[model samples]
Target: MDVPALLDWFDETARDLPWRAAGTTGWGVLVSEVMLQQTPVARVAPIWQEWMARWPKPSDLAAATQGEVLRAWGKLGYPRRALRLHAAASAIADDHGDVVPADVDTLLGLPGVGAYTARAVAAFAYGQRCPVVDTNVRRVVARAVHGAGDAGPPSTTKDMADVAALLPEDAAAAAKASAALMELGAVVCVARGPRCADCPVFDGCAWQRNGRPAYAGPAKAVQKFAGTDRQVRGLLLDVLRDTDEPATKARLDRVWSDAGQRDRCLDSLLVDGLVEQTPDGRFALPGEHGAVSPRG
Candidate 1:
């Protein structure tokens, strides 16, 4: 697969992301992985830097109120991830001596740490030789090895095995290779408008050999945020975040026109623990119901 060529290209062209910089701890890598999920790198980088500066260690983050974390999270969308990360930080502080776990199995035990996240932390942060498959890696593998245009519905077992086989035997090299493959898929072998001419392994690509056929697998669902419950939820949270005091029901209602939908979204936020209702029936971010000054 022209592994050397690919690695060399990565060595020269990899983005200067802060999380990948020298001396970044496992905690930093964990945070980057979580923030990068379904979010763009451009959006996550600044927030991640802010998070690292504010909460340098798991213990530091664990000590913060949920309101502080959510406020720090800003408009990263998927606010639940912030709460999950807070939960993970608390668990790390209480159980793991404030150190992010290096082993995949133990990492999997943390809140919101799924198989992909566990493997990513192990390989990228700890330099372990393990498969760290993501959408990019899956797409690259589908074309490079299987001659398929796109990866179909995800099968964790098969995806892990495919990537595991491609990794180098040496731990450090394998980790770098995993990162390189991900970078390749992200920038070169992208879902649309792939730049085959610039690909390091262009000569050996199976999909190119097969005439780069169109993907005929099951259609992937396109996610829409406008007019969705997610947008309404964001609006509701925005009001709570901007206010230092609990917002009244009337204030919350102003954000969305549909009373039924607004009420449902607010109720969902309360259930998710992202928002807390005060005794007076006003709503605020978690831990900010009666605080002197809300962090957000």
Candidate 2:
């Protein structure tokens, strides 16, 4: 594989993501990694930019309350990730002295950080010889290398080896190649429909030669939200997130109709650390500049 050529192509053609730019601080990289999890690049861009602008360092974020973090997170969904990121910032400040750890193990130890996130920080932030495999990277490797139409749900070891084998010898170059492959997969080798005509690895792609095969495995179940507990949770959190002070149960009750389901959702939020019960028995976002009763 012409690893250098691929990286060279990446250098020229890769999306100019704010987090991937020259001199992006490690904190910025960590924020981008968390926000990009299951979220699209376009959606992440402005939010990520706002985050980095507001809290340029881990210590800055550590100084913020969980309410601030979740509010900043907005409607990106999976609000637990915002809480985890806030916890991770505190860990970085207290343990690592506010520096994002370059070691994969240390990165993995951070709250909500996982396999792909660890390798991303190691390879992208530190320029280490680590394989950074997200969904996009997996799809590219599956089609271009193995001729598979799509990757099965993540099985880490095998996928890591496959990506490691493609990396160049030089650590920095290998990291750059990892980013290139991920970019190529995300933009040109996309699932559902691929733009093979624009692919950099088209000449050597195995799936292109064999003709793209249709995925036949069991499709994962999709979540429904119209009248589910999740929608109720969202309604409750939305009111809490927008408030300057803790909201009364009366205000929260207005968002969802069923009192039983609404109370259940509120309890769940308390358990999730997304909300807290105030001293006055009202509910507010966790750390929302007001006192709250400790969780049971």
Candidate 3:
């Protein structure tokens, strides 16, 4: 697929991401991978920079409390990831002596490090030749190579095989190719509407030739934000994030109109280890300390 041409393009055009700096620490790569999940690069860039500057290594993050990580997470949704990342840092510090694991299997054992993240850390941080397929790369492969309108749900085995087949034998070149493919997907082969003219694969794109047929499968589920438990959780967490002290149950109740949903969301947060309750029956983010409250 003119692999050298693609790699050359990536060498010249790849965005100057901080995580991609020469000899970037493995912990920095791990942070970037987690932050980029389902989040825009524009938003991730600044936050990633701030995070690395604040905690340059896994040991640094491990020393910080979970509350500190959640607070640093800011507007990034899916706060659970922040908690998991903090846990991962702690694990790295305790088990791996604060060094990010170079092996894919070992990285996978870390909290919140999934198949994609594992491969990304191995390839990007250690310069290993591994298939690193995310949503963007999946879409690009689906349309350009398979002639499909969109990628099916992520199944690492199939996706990785397809991407690996396209890689050059040299480890360094393979990593560069992977990045090129991802770049093509992100900027040119976008999901809602692709910029075909600007795409490097336009010449060989099967979906373009087929008139971009619409998928006949069931419609993608639309996530409802209003009145959902997730919305309630967001409201509840927002109050806690803004406050220095733990919030009373009564204070949290005011955020959600439905008592049942609010209680459910709060309970879910507690179950997920994201929030802790004080003895006085106030809730705060995990790691916020207070004396045990006596029974009412």
TM-scores of all predicted structures: 0.96, 0.95, 0.94
Which residue pairs in candidate 1 collide? none
In candidate 1, position 69 carries an lDDT of: 95
List, residue by residue over 1-296, the lDDT tens digit for candidate 3. 55776777687778887778897889999999999888888888898988989999888988888888898998788899998899899999999989999999999998899999999999888889999999989988888888889987777789999999989999988888888899888877888888887666677788877888876555777889888888889899999899989989899999988888888888888888778888777888878676343222
lDDT of each: 0.91, 0.87, 0.86
What's the CA RMSD for each of the models?
Answer: 2.9, 1.6, 2.2
Could you tell me the TM-score of candidate 1? 0.96
Residue-by-residue lDDT tens digits, candidate 1, 1-296: 77788889999999999999999999999999999988999999999999999999999999999999999999988989999999999999999999999988999999888988999999999999999999999999999998999999999999999998888899999999999999999999999999999999999899999999989799999988899999999999999888888888999999989999998888888888888878787888998555332222
Predicted structure 2: lDDT: 0.87
Q: Model 3, residue 60: what's the lDDT?
A: 90
Order the candidates by lDDT, highest first. 1, 2, 3
Q: By lDDT, is 2 or 3 better?
A: 2
Which candidate, 1 or 3, would have the higher TM-score against the true structure? 1
Please tell me which model should have the higher lDDT, number 1 or number 3. Answer: 1
Off by over 4 Å in 2: none
**Model 2: per-residue lDDT, tens digit, 8-37?**
778788887888888997788889999989
What lDDT does candidate 2 reach at residue 2? 54
